[model samples]
Target: MQIGVDPGSRYTGISLFTGSDAVSPKPVAEPAVVRAGVFSIEVQHRGNQIREKLTARAALRRGRRSRNLRYRQPRFDNRTRSVGWLAPSLRHRVETTMSWISRLQRWAPVAALHVERVAFDTQLLQDPEIAGRGYQQGTLHGYELREYLLEKWQRKCAYCGVSGVPLNLDHIRPRSRGGSDRASNLTLACISCNQTKGNQPVEVFLAGRPEMLARILAQVRKPLRDAAAVSSTRWALWKSLTVTGLPVHVASGGRTKYNRHRTNTPKSHTLDALHVGVVDEVTGWPVRVLVATATGRGTYTRTRTDRYGFPRLRLPRTKLHHGFQTGDLVRAVVRTGANQGTHVGRVAVRSTGRFNIRTATGLVQGIGHRYVRLLQRGDGWTYSRQPEQQPA
Candidate 1:
């Protein structure tokens, strides 16, 4: 026997087919002794067993409980400070629905279950307006339901028994023609097989696997025809939660700030400053000393500002002792933002302003010249004016 079970939001439908051999019962060889004497009995118990086995197997294979599960909606809105209290009520509705399905499954052990997948973009669920409108709780989309079945059935292609690659939710009755989104009209299919099937009917596509097709259809139809109603506890809990509104929670974190600053001044320049020069195209060699001056604070050497005004320090030399030497303590300013304060660290190396510096926290590595001040004597020469390191 073949069956097709359609489970829907409002009602479920079941269809079954009796095999040719089982259409009529065969006469039993042994007759029961009765007061009425000779009596004829028609029986085909073995045929029934075969049909039951197929039916049960199909049902077990389609053991998908839910489809396309998404993240739960947060209870509190950060912008509006508004609380969402409708989740509990909607939850109650889902609970009731699930309970009803459980009852049906319990009573119809021989009936197979088929759930149609739905196609809906879940990303839209993230929008508060859309979610609040109640679209999230609707029936699972066709693709989602098919994915659910594939997952529930352990990713084994119902027809080929192949596994691993993702399966597609195929329409028993191709949707391109006129198949509605219903449980009886869907099944799991491998990607290649699904593509080959295209919009073809299930019967046409499964011609090579007639028995499997028959069994799958029979399962879909039988549950609608013979299943008894049963309730689900999970549904009850969900319904209760929906009525009380989803749990609302709010959380926050602290923010930290950073900054850097730099300037150029020389004692030779008079205080009156007859002419103030604006930074006309601040361009220089990759390795250049950025100096900053403070009125009462004396003079401070800082690294050049990056194209974005952010301090970018580069190491000038690597072999420091006699050659820019390592472990040389240098002063620099933070030119990144509002903080624009003085920050100091020791150089671990002197290579293209690239080096490692040991700080109170630990060894700060890859120290760049933009983050350090070069010690110079006169005529822009350091120590003996011998260039020891090259710019990276």
Candidate 2:
């Protein structure tokens, strides 16, 4: 079996596929059968944790420098970043993906690996009509233009201010009326607005609302800040995946989308992984999709520490409290309390016998451990959701 992986920051899609001619108890009839699944890495404080810690550390340093200026030496040699240095959050994503790949290899005989190494052509995305020497004159590059448009238009129809509607890229000045297909001349409009505004100019269309026209023009000119820090790390992830000693096949984001659309499958990470490459058809089989979620084992630091890195409360010496760990999935039936109902989710074991159950709605704290029944042991992985079936 070969594996197809679509790795993202939070969720990694995985699919195991067997060739058409592969022998089975029941005769095989499909070109390929995809066993799709998603891996959701539940990192405690995932991305925000790193940001918070860095901010806190900086604040502390600033406070210290202000208080003791004479003793504190000013350091000025930390500006440059070394080669191939990835941010903590991005590195965590890569590590988690690799870890899952290693874990899955034990269960299946993975012959090859296919990954979507998406590299967005910022030039093409910003200005789709640019050809030949026109590329040299373009000023705006990267996803900033798209981000700017979305922000300026507030991700809604600029004409009507209607949100949650299917939007389309529309020309403020109609093409028939000599409008250049530049970013400045573009705006997002719902289907209704687009049809209503047919070939009419922005001024004529918004004749009744002069204020709206002024606002739209002003928003179009405003440029968005560059996102160099948020530049993609997909290529780096692709490089890391190549070390698995298997034949690695790489596909682009566009190709993946085209395949997915051709197959008429629902949009999802796992579904995308299943249709990563040139998949024409898979007949006579109902595809099973597994959803894997990461549930961390209890942390080494027992106590709940304060912002100043000081222990706030003493935790239990033993990790297991009444045969339940912090990350274990459990069903708690509260007999009597403010929240007197059955709550099911990951449990946060406490030393005082009052465990915290994280339900779908929110965390229900102060629940007695006696009421919690272990649904699944904390194996650092949880498959809470059932496998999704795709029609043949």
Candidate 3:
């Protein structure tokens, strides 16, 4: 089995599969997903939050020096950053991705790794069918513009927000009415919406709903930030992957787009991962994906501090209570209470023996520890399953 990875700033996708004709087994064999999922890395460590914290600390330090260093000599250039150093938040993306890659390698028979690199020049992308009319083919066949639109529209119909349907390339302002084939003038719509909106100007078609119409117009001009993110960390991730001792194969984002379009596969993070490197054909894939969000393995400092570095709240010295620690995956069966069903989720331990469980829906509080059984120990990730795409 080989693993393909779609590394992103916020979500890193993983897809494991065995080739169909590669001397596989009889019953348990095919070009199918062994397992696939995305790691929600932004939940625990977003760059903005880390940057804000650093800025706040710097300002606070300046204030303290103004008060206490009036009689003392001011020190400058006391700290050193090593060569090739990355900001904490940016480094977290690389570290987190490499950790999951290592974890998956240990868990499965990962023969090799395939990872998608940064975007290639538009010149590298070519479609034989649309070679002459380059701009006209962007929404469907061109890699850069098409992928940007897919991320922008979220692989859904822009008009009705309906997904899982083969969307048609739509002109927001009808081309015959004066719309240019620029990227900003384009959107996506379901077949029915496209037919219903034939020849009618967007302003007149959605005159009743000014809000959605305005939102769509505003979103058309929005830039694709995901491209910048992938570009920033692509080389870092590539260098880290080199040390794994696996035959690491790499390709450009444009190449993945080419492979995906050649096979006519729907867009998704995990599916994009599955088509990262060389592939003859994608025969089958799992409908459900296992989402493993990186939540971190609890922190050393238990105190919540204010801006001036004063302790605001102090957590318990002992993290474990009733033989269960916070962040542990547990299933609680309440016999008689408002929460009188089976609830399986991450548990937040309390000294009172009543823990709160964070379920997929929400959080359930005040459940006694006696009813809870350990399902899996928390290993810096929360595991859950979600359908790859809801059935239309």
287 in model 1: Cα distance from truth in Å? 48
* Tens-digit lDDT string for candidate 3 (202-305): 88989999998998988887866555655667778888888898889998666688777766777677788887876656766777787777666676777888
In model 3, what are the clashing residue pairs, if there are any? none
Per-candidate TM-score against the hidden true structure = 0.25, 0.69, 0.68
- Across 307-341, the per-residue lDDT of candidate 2 in tens digits comes to 87678987767888778887888999988879799
Q: Following a full C-alpha superposition, what root-mean-square deviation does model 3 have from the true structure?
A: 6.7
Give the Cα error of residue 346 in candidate 3, in Å.
0.9
Segments of candidate 2 deviating more than 4 angstroms: 19-45, 67-71, 123-167, 182-187, 201-231, 282-324, 330-344, 359-367, 370-383, 386-392
Candidate 3 lDDT (Cα, 0 to 1): 0.75
Q: After superposition, how far is residue 357 of candidate 1 from its true place, in Å?
A: 60
Q: Which candidate do you rate higher for TM-score, 1 or 2?
A: 2
How far out, in Å, is residue 160 in model 3? 11
lDDT (0-100) at residue 118 of candidate 1?
Answer: 20
